[model samples]
Target: MNLPSLRATERFANQMILDACRGAKRVHIVDYGILYGDQWPSLIKALSERAEGPPLLKITGIDFPSLVNLEKTGNRLVDYAKSCGMHLEFHSIATAAWESAQPRYHLFSELLFVNCQLRMRHIREDGIIDSPRKLFLEKILSFKPVMFFQSVVHADIGSPFFIHRFDGAWRSFLARLESFEETMKLELIDQSQLDFMDKFIEKCAMGAIACDGQNRVERISSYKTWDRLARKGQFGQLPVSKRALEMVMSVWSGHENFTYGMDENWLLLGWKDVVLNALSVWEPIEKLPRFKHQ
Candidate 1:
């Protein structure tokens, strides 16, 4: 959640989305499923220096509060917004609250269901609950934000969790993209610009790659979840670090047969389109695009 550099690749896509809507007087940033506002300071810092007309930023971060971490990061952002002179607001809504407030406040979800981790729990209680899926899609189609950008987990479609539904394979998982595309039904704006897989490959090939003694890298990925990768060892293998390994352990810990291509393995799936938006494929980050004000 702590993107060391506010302008780096890991955080670039989300930043680009906000930057695209920079001219709006009241920018409603809806962070529903995942709430990590620690990223706000870096964003506010980056935005304050922009040459465009400064919009009176009205920020709203929505979330399933009980399920996620909101306090620390939210407090930090509230403070940052006040300091930057941006009009601020926060809406912490849960599913039950959403049901009651559906009369007025908009209820929306910009997610592909496989990512929700809600497929099973609902079915257990209702014995065959398809209503929420429709609700999920309905909210999205209805809200139709001015500038919409979201990451839907599309790997291993029909995951073991939904084996009966997705059939479970990388191809099956990616196939959902088409169904999702047909669902939300947005203005097809190809806004991709970062070659994450190629960059990872290049980073792995170059001396930029780093690894631990056992050749494993301890990675705390986007969800702040812990991952342990270790190389071949004397009887078995040993983790490089008890917690998180540094850069040295990352190089060799990467997938050896990692094929960085145009296919699904690519981290930033829409990099090609975004780069097309920038009108050129850049080395890492896409050069900023000029978004028209609404």
Candidate 2:
């Protein structure tokens, strides 16, 4: 997500962390799927800018080794921390699933935060938790985070909840793509830019649509389902205030294209109104392996 889209998320996350850490000297945040490091600068800057913030902000990033360059990303974060006057220590653990990986306890503090964004869907793509996904969540909750900041692209195609709305959503995405294409044509965009847009349309816009015989299903579930999984794993949603929601939506309110909607407890965002289904995958309950919260 872009910085504007994530402004409210960062605020909510920082508030939760501060509230949870109340009297703590330090805060430890565990970030899952730290892809290319676009998500952190704003959050880190916000926390450091907080006058009442903890003395130390330690973040542990977890992802597959082959997918991320740990040392390189860690160095970039360390540099930002140093400039911001926060005692920043970053540790990168190479693991595909948290269930199988181990995080050194010495890095943790009294307050723990788990950050997951747009990446958990892959874990439930098969409609089952299987072993790794369950274990991954189980291990994180083992740290007993004060709050888990999870931002899934909600698109619950599994339920009739969005049955009637799917068409509108599809149209919106298509319109956005068409508008962009027209703009490109007007500007006579280069071949590379055209290529990028093609990829975005294929992977993002089109990939979100689920029809018969299509392998790319919108695996995102509703907030209710997520609540069930969170409850199973021993975490709960952070209650967000009305003002906060408005503030988050305020940035996009005047925008002509992008749309946002609310359902159950999920606040959905997209290029248009096509969020009838959750964008992430769901896990099948019957197939979930027994996991007693650690």
Best by lDDT: 2
TM-score of each: 0.44, 0.70
Candidate 2 Cα outliers beyond 4 Å, as residue runs: 1-12, 18-23, 52-54, 106-109, 124-129, 157-197, 204-224, 270-272, 276-294
Instruction: For residue 107, give model 1's deviation from the true position in Å.
Output: 13
Looking at model 2, which ten-residue stretch has the lowest summed lDDT? 285-294
Candidate 1 deviation (Cα RMSD): 18.4
The lDDT values for all models are: 0.31, 0.58
Across 1-294, the per-residue lDDT of candidate 1 in tens digits comes to 111111122243334444444554434454444355654565566565566744444344544556566565566677886787654555544442221223223223221111111111121111124343234433433444433232222222211233333232324223323322322233343323123323433343221123322231211111100001000100111122211112212321232221112222122222212210000011101111223224
TM-score of 1: 0.44
